[model samples]
Target: MSNRVDELEGQVAELRAAVNGLTEELVETKDRLRKLEAEAASEAEPPAERETKSDDHVVVVEQEQDDVDVATDSLGSDTASEAEPGEAAVEPEETTENDTNKSTDDIIVA
Candidate 1:
């Protein structure tokens, strides 16, 4: 009976050691998973889309009214005649430095 009790006690000790080892491994694994998830979330967003602030400074986007054309030409221009109500006007970008002689009627094939 004593020998049988000793054997049972040894088995219980082995089981307790195994459970402790498995618990430590589980905790370590959970920590590693949390770190990996944080890294993935940070990488998913670009620098422009992320909300960020530095030293009490925040970034702001400003739209200048001077860049947009709100009034139509009264001199019978094609842009003014062809524009529809409730539609935004589009201004052509200057592509060349020597555009002094270029007309609005010129077709840019590129």
Candidate 2:
């Protein structure tokens, strides 16, 4: 009976060691997986992604400003037309078309 108990105890100890080793291996695998995922995410974001994101923001800002200008122009026109006599009503035109021209004149000294 004592020998049987000793044998059972030995089996339990072996199982515990195996379980500990397996737990350690699982943890290491999970850490490696997390590192791989992070690397993949970083690699997936190319320079073009950043440029597209910046262009999107610029477009959104330009659209919002255009909307505001349209609103203000409409309001001004309404007020101007409602004004009493003797005022010369002038319609606003695109005066500075050159202002929108992007010239790559600045040389980068590197």
- Each model's lDDT comes to 0.73, 0.77
lDDT of 2 by residue, 1-110 (tens): 99999999999999999999999999999999999999998888433212224564463223355567888999999998799888776997865656445343354667
Compose the digit string of candidate 1's lDDT tens values, residues 35-73: 999999888854323334544677555334433333233
lDDT of 2: 0.77
Which portions of model 1 miss their true places by more than 4 Å? 46-110
At residue 59, candidate 2 shows an lDDT of: 32
Q: Give Cα distance to truth, residue 70, candidate 2, Å.
A: 18
Name model 2 segments beyond 4 Å from true.
Answer: 46-110
CA RMSD, predictions in order? 16.4, 16.1
On lDDT, the candidate that comes out on top is 2
